[model samples]
Target: MFVTESFNRQLDDLLERICSKLQISSAQHRLAQDRYETIGNWLGARESPLAMFNPVIYPQGSLRIGTTVRPCSGQEYDLDLVCEVQLDWRQVERPVAVLDAVEQRLKKYDTYKTMLERKKRCIRVNYANEFHLDILPACPDPSSGTTCVVVPDRDVRGWKPSNPKGYAAWFESRAKTFEVYLAEHQEPLPSQEPVEMKAPLKRVVQLIKRWRDLKYADDQKIAPISIVLTTLAAEHYGGQQSTSEALAGILAGIVASIPPRNQRLLVLNPKNTKEDLSEKWDENPDAYEAFVSGIIAFHQSWQDIARGRGIPSVSATLRDLFGEDLTKSVVKEQAESIQKARSEQRLHMQKSTGILSGLTTAGSVSVRSNTFYGSQEVLP
Candidate 1:
């Protein structure tokens, strides 16, 4: 509503580009479905509880978009088709073993098993084409607290459910609320309301997103892809946005556009690993080195900006911006001075309380030991 015109066009172009690339031709969808259903059938045949394919989570959206928004273009987050399996409809086991077995079973097919591997929580299968499936092994565990999702050998702490249907419902609810909030706070939507809404929303979204990218990268020291998505929900009403939005926003801004120094943290291009990560970093060492320095410098700049803004959470701000030791130190002389003062006060208090007297006061000479002590001692 109140947004600049250029920002609106950019948003439209981005969404259009993303959606166009994601259009599911019937043939392609059918193939994906065949593979998905085949995997499901395989799991069910294993006497595993009935498996269901969730359509909502398939084409990863804005979160994945954020991953690609970095300066180095080819860094892509995986497109995950998360399959939630009801193993007994009560709890899910370490489906890694199942994934292992499934990969083995599918290996002979050769069409589907080349890149399949059991990652932390899922069976990741790479297709001959660029598309991939992150077949997350899940069983409902009430002990998983409110989320009811569990990953074996991994702490379930701070994890949330990503079921497509459930997440879609949640997102729809949030979108409705966000739309309402926008209408109330901003000018009335244009006759072409949908078109009009696109720009401001896009700019704000991107700006907030850029901020999130920064905070997650620089301050939180979180994984790049993680910061991208988490920052999105924090910046916009993505149904799943939680209480952590404020912190997410702060962290995102702090770490925006950071060139990753750690090779382990780099997300290589899915199609060409060497081209995306190794070769680029190796060839342009000077540029990459400059990029890292720039990130740290920008983080410092954000610290000043945040301080100026009077944002709370000092610990978080400090962690993201730069490394510094804020802990107060106790120098020996200072400790001695403090201890002497405390002993004198203690002696004075004891004298006032009518406790044992004729005492050597702290910081006074001890006759027997011939030593100057900082505490009181009875002369008796």
Candidate 2:
């Protein structure tokens, strides 16, 4: 009942295609980068309060990790940026003051003033349908080494520690291992440049995130956040060379990494120990249950495919897992490719045999029946 190597290849191809579709296009990537750079320049201007602190703005989340996905229907992709203000936390007692300062500077620009929205720890600037930039104001934390910084928490009315850059570095290191494996074992992706390698870990994360989006399209509030999925998947990755194997491995092991909680599960931030990625799990049990169910469903679906059981067709199962549109597209493309190969094989056999429709003609039937082991007439 085990699936054949050919089937596995087909499945991997389909999954890779789906991942490609989910990726943010290069043009969009450049646009986001340009927008952020302009904002950084404005914040680092001589007259700005942030300029005195040597503020540096950079990406920190999925965009930095190369795991960014296109936003779902009617939603904007978030570009998480850290506005690192180089100042001692002790000197600036009020952390919220830093947030206020940044907001005020942004208010100077009428356009930005209208687009800005204050969040728990960051200022969000909306770019209409393109994307939203979440700028987290952070200052150096003396206790947590150089990489750590204290970000403001309006809800707690205090400063909290975080290390977005450190976390991104750790994630990038993991991503590199997969990239090297891909370089050695596979051809470069058509969409990627020769020098630019696609990491299997990134692809795996993208796939899981896309699945989460589809599953929770209606109730996004309860769905597991990107950091949770990214962290868990990266933590559980076994350096598998293939995306399908990596995904199956992650799905199987991700649940084990979730700490058991009578009330709430705690997914600790690897860089900053104080932060919990799954903090919302405590308030919404249904969301946590949904996440658990999703992992189980994903793992079981892959297992069923591997074992050739339960599912009526791979396409149907994949459609249920991903979405109807993406699944159908991949399946159709694969079917057409298979048909072309079969047709080519038939044409090749016909040419090799020199047979065209009928073999009753003299030239077509060159080998005579009298040609035997010791016969005078040799077999043509």
Candidate 3:
């Protein structure tokens, strides 16, 4: 379903609310750790052995916690409590059964009920929603021979697993490093004292992730999102600027870019803003057109580079064409080099083909003319 303008605005508001709620300004690691510990205690009291789950039990589907280092939107302040368990769980028990167990366990917490219910379509959720916590459960595909996979909700069936251990270990280690990092940086912890990642890049990642989600939420394809992300990173961090400036600048761009369509996806205060935001639809047709057109351009540019049709330059004109994305430019340089290498290979092959063709023609002429019969200099 297409997200309406009001919903998009709501999502924007929601993002800002989350950022404000992230009380741990300095000790991000501590904030994350505290939340995990709170969740852990809740889980322990509710489901001990089952909740006592190790980060590596499944080797295939382990659990971990981390700051939203790489969110779909730049300001989408999020924390993930992910579980990567064995794929065999499906065959042994069933996906529904696993979901039921998780849902039941979550119900024990009054704070997690409402939010969990909203995610029912995505996963089995309950209620008492406060913080922005996402429970991503993943398992490997037994038949496909893949290592691990995950789906946002149990309703659909596609899984992805990137750094199983790293994800699961994030929760356990973030708190310690966050405190140390903050102390070193001379920043104050927020009143809430939330856990945060000590690494500066990780926060930047969260900002980028927020934009990614927002862009893709508008459309499933990733061209424009990739470009904008790359461009922003390059322009902000390319020279004398500090990582902090880069992060803040990117965050500003993302919040400013929220589409009007997203407004309909909002779950709160749906009635009040409907009329005013709706009129902007006709008023800002150009802006809407530009957003769509930008994505199309990004898609075409990427396709051209892939097919050896363009300059193979990623970060140069292509990024400027879209907006910004650090990933594409960094990857673009390598892609261009690879394309050049392949072109050289084709030239070498063509030269060899020409040599063979000439040899074949010369041999045929000599045979037909009967001038090669005693040519000993020709050597066999």
Against the reference, the lDDT scores of all candidates come to 0.38, 0.76, 0.38
User: Model 1, residue 260: what's the lDDT?
Assistant: 47
Per-model C-alpha RMSD: 24.1, 10.0, 22.5
> Clashes in candidate 3: how many?
69
lDDT per residue (tens digit) for residues 219-276 in model 2: 8998899998998888888888778888888888976655565544567778888777
Better of 1 and 2 by TM-score: 2
Better candidate number, 1 or 2, judged by lDDT: 2
Off by over 4 Å in 3: 1-24, 27-29, 44-76, 85-87, 118-130, 140-147, 150-153, 157-380
Best lDDT among the predictions, by candidate number: 2
Q: Each model's TM-score, in the order given?
A: 0.40, 0.83, 0.36
In terms of TM-score, which candidate is strongest? 2
Q: Which ten residues in a row have the lowest lDDT in candidate 1?
A: 1-10
Candidate 3 structure quality by residue, lDDT tens digits, 1-380: 11111222222222233333322344654655666566655544634444544322221111132233323333334455544444454464345554555566667677766656435312322222323555555555434333334333344432222333433343234224434656777677576865442333333444444434544565543323322343333323322122333344444444344556545211111112111212323445554455455544444543443333223232244334323463344334433433343333321112322211112232232112222221211101
Please count the clashing residue pairs in each candidate, in the order shown.
Answer: 17, 0, 69
When sorted by lDDT, best at the front, the candidate numbers are: 2, 1, 3
